[model samples]
Target: MGCATPWCLATLVAIALALRSGYAVSGLVLVSGYYFPTARTDFWLTSAPAMPLLGDLMRYTSPPIISWAIMPKLMRTLFAPRAIPPEFKNEFPISLALRPKQLRAAAEESAFLIPAAAQLRLQYRVSGVQLGSCMERLTGSSRPTSRRLHAVLPSSLLHLVEDAGHMVTYADAAGIADAVAALAPSAPVRTA
Candidate 1:
């Protein structure tokens, strides 16, 4: 986590500079869970009638859809950590620990989920790693969302493998250099 902070901070700084310089930012969002908005639903509804209605409709409609459309994946995300064999954990550097307290917190706290969801959504606009990697790191397991994200994310986007199973980190020096070089404008060549 400590090693990855600088990389995350640097990316944010780069993004701010890019936006300030008038470069358009766009991206895809891939997450295992929903990201609720910061503002109250009533406030949002007053400004845009469609917002609250959509959310309310989703709340009512999503149950069936989630059961049929989302449950399999969600189950995989919940259970994958347990499937990791004891031998495998011994062999690999990674260790999966179940902390029900943290899981409960994540389930209840919008703050924990919102940023991750936002990051996934933003990935489509700016090249980034698949969301699964980030989730895996956070949950200490390889989630189906991570696999789905890899399949869904376009090939052009960059993938940063971080400590968290589904978290993306930009600590790869070569990758960072390459990205910077690619984004940096080429100097005009002068004929000798």
Candidate 2:
């Protein structure tokens, strides 16, 4: 629970924060790619291309239909008076996504400060999948690559799980558990 796996582009900001802050974070388990604070081209070139028919196919599920299916459970959850933190309660996840320039600024600031804190840091590991065969990766003209990851996290351990995709946890939970155990021997691994 204490460790964090900042998924996708979220790793860009999270890593910057961890490096900039003086706190000795337990670890960062990066899932998928670690986005670098580079130009928009760097990101766009790697993303999947959108096709018209596929786009329509992806969005074909009606919102009302989805609401009808899940609204009752959602309402039940919302009705519960949970002591959630203010940040969690009020925060919109989309608001956290940073533009390339914003990401660059954070990276520059972090790069300057990281040297001072580098010696005091703890474990930082990365894990990616063998195949991200979902529509997004499948549609992309070029194969998905973590070309920038090495430059960003040169010292961190990297793990590639076989037969996994963007939804790595669902594809291979046991592999993830094994990776965690390998990273931190004391970490508990629950099997169902």
Candidate 3:
């Protein structure tokens, strides 16, 4: 599955940038970010808290309850390819993320990505222009995203970094920083 640090928000920002708002956005940075509006089996589980009327009530109920059972695996999965820090294990605000309200936000944001990506896909002209497209090194399903984006935007840069998966910023901060620095108008700077 593709992701983002809340890709729903990223999709919104992409929309804004596409609209050419007062603010300028050079590119969209995705971390485990999903591009297509395609469905995932997990969608129902994560997006359930986003349902109208029931969404509000569901948060304090079954979904969150079930999530508690899965959080350890979820946390481990999110931090894969790297060990979870002791700081995160000992002191991070896990409860805050597990809070009902937080679940609601996550659910809603996850739900928003599909339509948003669809809109972004539709916005691009078939004029053979391109955007830089980088994707995570994980997820078999995610591999097609770059290809699909490249198909639409033929000039898209496909920079595939090995093991660039969920929570990769933490896994390789220097690499991430270096990647960002390289994207700058100026020459790349040392990020480590």
Candidate 4:
């Protein structure tokens, strides 16, 4: 009935906003997030849908012959160490993610990420809002390295889920809920 994952980019937005003086945020739960990023081959590949002539060519083209064949494998890899949920496989609108407009936005965000990180890097704040990182304990993931993550969120508490990967959101809903609840304030959160 809903998206399986929260839009992870919102974490970066929060961090950007939080870096400003007196930006009050009560809490943040960083789940399998990216920080201190580098452009990847996937960036160039996926960005085809966002390029000018290629964007038109891609959207009009049927089959997207390559992605059509490889998407399943990519999806499976994304959720490795755990199987993609039937609901996700059935209900997820892969087309939405592949659409030219959406691809453009994703590309824009990916492009912006590096500059955002570079600008925000090493900036300190007097604010001490609660921050935590959530991920499944797996051999591989798309998440930021722990050392880099700690540099970004120095105060974050780690909540690692066993036998899962970056897809920890789907791996254990209860565990994620518990982590969020732990970040929840006993009283209502107030922001300045």
Query: Best-fitting candidate, measured by lDDT?
Result: 3
Error of 4 at 60 (Å): 3.3
Prediction 4 TM-score vs. true: 0.76
In model 3, the Cα lDDT at residue 4 comes to 32
List ranges where model 2 is wrong by over 4 Å.
1-6, 37-147, 186-192
Comparing 1 with 3 on lDDT, the higher-scoring candidate is 3
Q: What would you estimate as the lDDT of candidate 3?
A: 0.62
Stretches off by above 4 angstroms in model 3 are 4-12, 18-21, 126-133, 139-142, 186-192
Q: Per-residue lDDT of 55-112 in model 2, one digit per residue for the tens?
A: 2332334422443466445433422222333553456242232333333333343343
Best candidate according to TM-score = 3
Listed per model in order, the count of residue pairs whose N, CA or C atoms clash below 3 Å is 20, 0, 2, 0
In model 2, what are the clashing residue pairs, if there are any? none
Worst 10 residues of 3 by lDDT: 126-135
Model 1 earns a TM-score of 0.27
Q: What is the C-alpha RMSD of each candidate to the true structure, in Å?
A: 14.2, 15.1, 4.5, 4.8
Native RMSD of candidate 1 (Å): 14.2
The 10-residue segment with the lowest total lDDT in model 1: 94-103
lDDT of 4 by residue, 1-192 (tens): 001123445556777676665776667665555545564555555445557786767755742556567789978876777888899999998877766566566656655655665565555334466565544344544344444666556687666666666576787788777767877647575799
Q: CA shift at 163, candidate 3, in angstroms? A: 3.1
Tens-digit lDDT string for candidate 1 (39-83): 333232222212345544543453334435654464344334334
